[model samples]
Target: MAFIGASRGAAQGRSASALAARLGFRIGLVGLFSGTLLLAALLLFSLQPMFTKRVLPILGGTPAVWSVAMVVFQALLLAGYAYAHALTRWLQPRAALATHVLVLLAGVVFLPVGMAKGFGAPPAEGEALWLIGLFLASIGLPFFALSASAPLLQAWFARSGDARSADPYFLYRASNIGSFAALLAYPLLIEPLLGLDAQARLWSLGYAAMTCAVVACGLRLRNAAPVAAPVEAELTVEASPRRRLAWIGLSAVPSALLVAATAHISTDVAAIPLIWVVPLALYLVSFILAFRPAQPGPDRTGRLLSGLQIAGTGCAFAVVVFKQTPFLLDLGLTLGLLFVNALMAHRAVYALRPPAARLTEFYLCTSFGGMCGGIFAALVAPHLFSGVYEYPLLLAAALLCRPGVTAGGLPAVLREARRSAVPLIGAFLAALLALVARGPQLGIEVLMVCLVLTLAADWRSPARASLVGIAIGVACLALQAAVMAEGGNHRSFFGVHRVYTSPDGQFRLLVHGTTIHGAMRLRDDEGRASTGRPVPATYFAPGGPLSDVFEISRRVNGAIPAVSVVGLGAGSLACHARVGEAWTFYEIDPVVIRLAQDANTFHFLSECAPDARVVQGDARLTLSGRTEQARVLVVDAFSSDAIPIHLLTREALAIDFAHLDAQGLLAFHISNRDFSLSHVLARLAAERDLTLLQRLDPPRQPSVGFAHSPSEVVLMSRDPAVVREAKAMGWRAVTPDLSRRPWSDDYANALEAMRDRWRELLTSAR
Candidate 1:
């Protein structure tokens, strides 16, 4: 009896040991997959800003460059998802693993990623296509390989025999969290700490580590049952076409809005990576919230959607009232609208998510939708619409994505249209009356009434709400367009350029985004053309700091022989050109040149600089082959108030200095609302052992002849005497802040550079 009892105890101990070992293995598998996904997403997101920063100098540092880059990424993501779907559908587990590993190894050849050489200079036209080709050739393989990892790994986990393998959508949350972390860390941590080369090296190491983790994940699941040989009972419904279309529609709205919002906010604020990341970070956060294991109930989702819709409509109203809102408030409103609207749409997407068997297919459809949205925003919209009409259109589309909106199909849609027709038609007539009467204030009041009525009418019916919301949006945009109808709108790869007469009707102003680029005094107080040669107005007023740079240069050098200007803003600087002096202007945007050359718009270029040469293309690319040395070089290039950091970097300065005579003066127009660029210029001068002087001229009250706006100019020279003489006039010798690093082609931190200005703003607000 004692021997039998002992045998029973040993058997029970063995069984317990086996159970513990199995539990440990399962936990290890989960960790490996999760960690691999996290690392892969980090590398994927961080690569965007890193690689784009490197290319900004190649092209001019325009925000449009970032838009095109997003399109490439979305396209690559779709391709990666399709590849994953194919592998899972046709290949066995071991074969699929081998294939993916080989693809990753192929990607390794492009490690330590940077732009590919031999692409040469980009074209004057078709820049979008050229840029797309460049990205594909340079970073395509590595990015493609990395993009496949998320879906492939999730699919792998589905077949891994783990307890939660039957529902692998939870892993998606981990992927986006990594994405969010990477985006936040980039501007805040990585950009401030590491140069581009260092970032590339560290990223390559992370990629290699992630690859090993992916391989380990494959090994962990090698002996498990094949995907086709499913054992446990689970959801197996084949995704119908209608369901696939629903997924696509739900995904497209946020993706398009992501691009549109980025463009809108960045155009007004600075077009730095930090601004670009905010919208994208919110977008990823929406995905994280949407794909969570638990979601809100139907009633809760409906309330959330309604709240967001109302808030978004209110924001639209604010945009109409203040054509150019305060930068910070505008940014907050834009991002808030994006987050709420995206969350609502993505929640609907998660509701229609397919089961584990169709995971890759589901991802493929979603990615394809994203690619479509990006394509529309980046490639098509600029050519199709004269203004940023896509933004409002997408906003309206987002409202339509609310739940139960299309429950009654075509018949339901007809009923909603009938119900909404009276209000919509009434709003249209009211808008027409406002336009015909030419009453701006009355137009605004009518818009307010229409919006309120629309929101209050059938607020519960998504169809009625969506239709009226679109009408309201269209009316608002149309009203704004009419208000600016006196101006001619021109769209280019760069941005919108509007030429309009000022409210006082004394100056013809050229505006980009919210900032006035140049203003020409067209008529005196008597409403007649001025007699003498047209003088540069606005920032280029006769007594301004920019004029002082030329005066001091002429004083030191005896006579200014040649002059080169980087930005051709109304060609105002051309009037400053003296006879017998060779003057050249380098302009990137063809549209700006056209407008400046049109004598009807502003005659600074045609009337004053007709004899001057104008070079087309980015100054960085166009100035490299210049033969003549200039005694004075002015760098006044700007896309709105945002200065191109590439043009201010050490490498860029070297190029400018190379084209300048030894005694030549280099003047940078540093007038900006958000940044104190004197700090940047001071550091650059110190690093290069050059002398620097800055002058900040305060604004004068508007006069009838020429309005003198505030201007700031920083002058740099190899000759100390030149800058010293300028200092005697009105310029102050600036000291470099040793605590801050100088910007270079390899490194820059626009956010950190703006820290002082931000502090000043906060103090003033307080």
Candidate 2:
């Protein structure tokens, strides 16, 4: 009896071992699918900013470059999803796998990716189209291949006959997780650690590894039995027109919001990859959470996030309405709104998802919607509105997606309508009365509060939620109209620029993203428009370091014959052009040139230097074509508070040097609120064995026709006499730190620059 029992126990042990091995094999197969898709996603997303950065210099770092890049990416993504959908729908399982593998191998030919050759100079006109063509020629094929991986592999997994394959949508969450990781890592780790060339090589290696994993996943699928015909047929449910439209609408709002938020935030900050990554990272995180399986419990967490979304939208609206909000607060509120709205929109998409059989179709619709949104925001809105209307429009669209009252028949709808209408009508009347009795400020406040309350009360009803959102958006527009009535508000592909008289009517300022690009004193203490001449204000004030450049240059090198100024903000520096001096302005934006040259808006260029030739294009590109060398070249092409980094790179400097005389003084306006560019300039000076002299001009009292803001200028010259004269004029010798690396076209790091600035601030504070 004992012997028989032992034999039975041993048999049972073998049975358990066999089952364990089978389970492990299934898990490994699923892991291969998930892991390869994740890697593919990482490569796809990280390459976006990487390649865009490479192309930025070509176009002069216009914000539109990023916008156009987004449109291209979305279009490619749609193409990829469509390809996957077609391949799966037409081919047998083994044939589809074979075709996809061939595409992967073909993509390998485009390895060690960087910007393609022959796009050396951007055309003066039709820049957006040129950029699209450039991207298509360069990274298009590899990116399209990578974009197809998620949908194609998921479709393959669904046909593999494993239990996990029954619901392959979970792999999407894994894909976004990889995307989120890549975006975060690019700014924080990859960009800071590796140069663009090194990054490209590393990405190539990653792609090779992902190809191996894809082959493994394909092998596993091949070993498994082909999907039963009945099962495959069962998965082919046609989506109704309504459901497809819902998917597109749900996808469009978040996509538009992403572009708008990035544009809005980066306008106030630098338009570099570090700032660019934050919005995109939040966007990916939203996808990761929205697509993940719902937790087993009451969805209190989701409801809370929904509430936050509404609240954040309200806060963002308030910030826009009241333009005096602090920068940090404004940034936080806008980013918070983006995060919550994206979460809500993506969750809606996830909830409406079809079975694995329709997986590629769903992604195709989503990608199409995304492409449409990108085109509207990046292509249409700039031309459609004088301001950033898309931001508010997208905000309203996001609110419209909120879960709302969708129950009962006509009577039930009428009941819900009545419940919503009473409060809205009452609030509208109250706002009207407030406007008549008090003022626009009080009226707008009342309307905003009412909208917020209505949205909160009817949070579950889409109609009511949309009504509230539209109401708020209309109110905001009215406020903007009122503000623009003062005249001189202009919007372009770069950013918003406003020309407004100061409170005292003593100065007219050209403001861009809360930074004063140019200010002209309009009246004297006697309350009359100054009749003598227009004076250079802000950084170019008469006694500022910028003035010192001309003063010392004229003193040391004799009469200045030619000067080239990059960045033509209100053409304030044009006031510095002496008679007989052939001054040229290299301006990127035509709108800026128009605003600055208009005698009605600003008379600096007209009244001070009417003959100052304006070369309208990216300074780097335009300057490269110039044959005349300048005695002085002023680098002052900052877009609001953001640095045009392409203008400050080593390659750019080489171009500038080629356009300068032997003793030409290169004056860099390094007075930035967020970055210490002195170190960067110092390093560049050292590389050329040039003398670097810097001056932080002392602050002055605010007087009519004079700017009070202190300016920091760095002067680089190979002439010892020029440096000696600058030093005698209170310009201190700028010491280069051997530890700091000079920023090149292939290797600039905004994060490092920001960190150095922070360290300096800390040291100064101590």
Candidate 3:
């Protein structure tokens, strides 16, 4: 019975192989086509992380980068679509084949998977246009070829297909499956096991194989379609190019929305390693479900799921806006909303798809939409919307997509509904406003009661009335977000900079990414002291990492420490130096220095290291040109949520090491919400023959190093004896270079490494 069932299932499956053979399918051409498609997927997926990492300095690593990249990608996709479309005419099939092959080969003049030597250098803010041009020069061809795969191959397949019947739609889905698999596989397997060099080589080999395949496919097409007009298959729906573009926009928007959600929610908060892939995985899965032909179309599910999305969106925003929601619940709401939104939007796209004749055009359009969504959410949102309000904005967009989906908290057909004892909508609103305007347990408890009443009132239309209920339940969220945005929260290329204002108005705390960077009360903020005098608060507060620059120099160099801070966050560390101490600060954002030295925020120049020189550029590149030397250096250039992968590379560290006097100290502020970077330091130290110690020091005390948990500042040195000193002070020697090779400017990938460690991290949550 089991054998029979298996055989039966196999028989029912689409028999493309036998059908092709029967129809005299040019096996070589088909093979080449499939190979090329696979190659494109593999190359694109493998290089995504590497490429995304390279452009960070330009994009400035804000949530906006995701949006900008998305838009940029979508626009690229449209160009590719237009290119392929244009190529079908003027250029014969053989000519197209010859031209594309030559183009692919030409991209190699700038070979290997890594970025150029000086692509990410700062002060490019003024030269951003030129920077983009340079970046495009580097990435355009590879991206163009890879982007052209689906449509180009599909067109090739159609032109060489069976005389009586040719189906291209199914092949598009196959390509999609391949692309998605590669996307998941990158983080899940490839990135962890392979460095960027290896991955790039592997991709090149795949492209080579694809090139061979394209040769055979083109030969087959020339032989078969010789001066003959191809038959036009009957189409159920014929859409203009412009309509197709709309389809692309539709898909791109949702895709970008997904990216934004991932960036905002997990970028700085998820205490997991390289977990950015999860949301992207879901996004790809939507393609799997959406591209496949639905039985009655995905509309039924789309409509139902879309409603739930609205609810999820409303609740999520309400939680944030009202500021009364738990953090975990907030994340859960976001994830839920995202999952549902993808399903609904993707299924809607699947439903709108035409037959095989228009399939490539359809997919081209879908890809276009995905690009748009990505740009809006990833690039535009962070800059445009002061708060991380992407969820609400996406939800609002989704609601518009659904058309006539009511948000007034009243079901459209309210007259037919069963009557309750009373209407609490107005009462609910009144109570919420009163509670928000008031204070203490009395007000909060009363507000909670009102929240419950409003939820009950809207129970009839949970899907449509979610936003209203959210408004009531977490009405304080709006106030919190507004207050937080006005002054407390700031978004920049460096990530989410959140400064919380305490109810007492006596303290201000700076939270970057996921960790609390500084917590200084007015008393602490106002006065600074080391062995005496006022000091600015932050990581460089008199006794912190900055002070180590001076203290270590005295111990190692004897007189004073010439220190360099990669990121001069308010120049607070300058105050820690004693007289005759020389210090140079490398700051990427001039705006940060301007604000820090504003005198109103907190004066560090008058209070601390009075004559600090600020070098305005990327620390990595700037250090490359510096002739100065430091006894101690801190690579706290953990700019933005987007980790400057290059700075963490062996090349960057070696440069820092070069600038250091022998027997000097290199302190790396390994503060991150996701991934234990200690492993990374361990790897870097091993590669460069250095010793390392991980430390976490509480305020006004000697630093304590913990080997067990993640939050740490790594102290490394070429001198093993100095590391021994740190270990004697409770600093456990962290295991370095236990993973693979260290990442470098040329190429580096820790995705696969992070993936391997996933089970360990997820265990706690599980």
lDDT of 2 by residue, 11-109 (tens): 999999999978887898888887898899899989998999888877668667888899999999999999999998999877887888788888888
State the number of backbone clashes in model 3.
42
Candidates in order, TM-scores: namely: 0.96, 0.94, 0.78
- Each candidate's root-mean-square deviation in Å? 2.2, 2.7, 7.6
User: Which candidate model has the greater TM-score, 1 or 2?
Assistant: 1
Against the reference, the lDDT scores of all candidates come to 0.83, 0.83, 0.60
Error of model 1, residue 551, in angstroms: 1.0
What is residue 321's positional error in candidate 3, in angstroms? 3.3
State the lDDT of candidate 3 residue by residue for 1-766, as single tens digits: 9999888888865476577664556555555566667667666655555565456544334343443444555666677776776666457787898887787777666566556665545443543344445556666677776677778778777766444226655555566667677777876677667655676788777767766766666777776654223335343457966556546645754686677676666455431224455666667666667666666644466556655754565465446455566555766676667666676666656656665556556766776677667766655666776567665556555543332222221354253233321434554555556657863333444554555554445644534343444344344444445456534566654456665644544445555554444433354323442234444455555454445445654665477558777776656566667788788888766556655555555456545665788877767668889887887787776554335565777777878888987756888886553446777778888877777777765443343211012334788876655665566555667776564667665445555445535754788569
- Candidate 3: minimum summed lDDT over ten consecutive residues — where? 701-710
Number of clashing pairs per prediction, in order:
0, 6, 42
State model 2's lDDT: 0.83
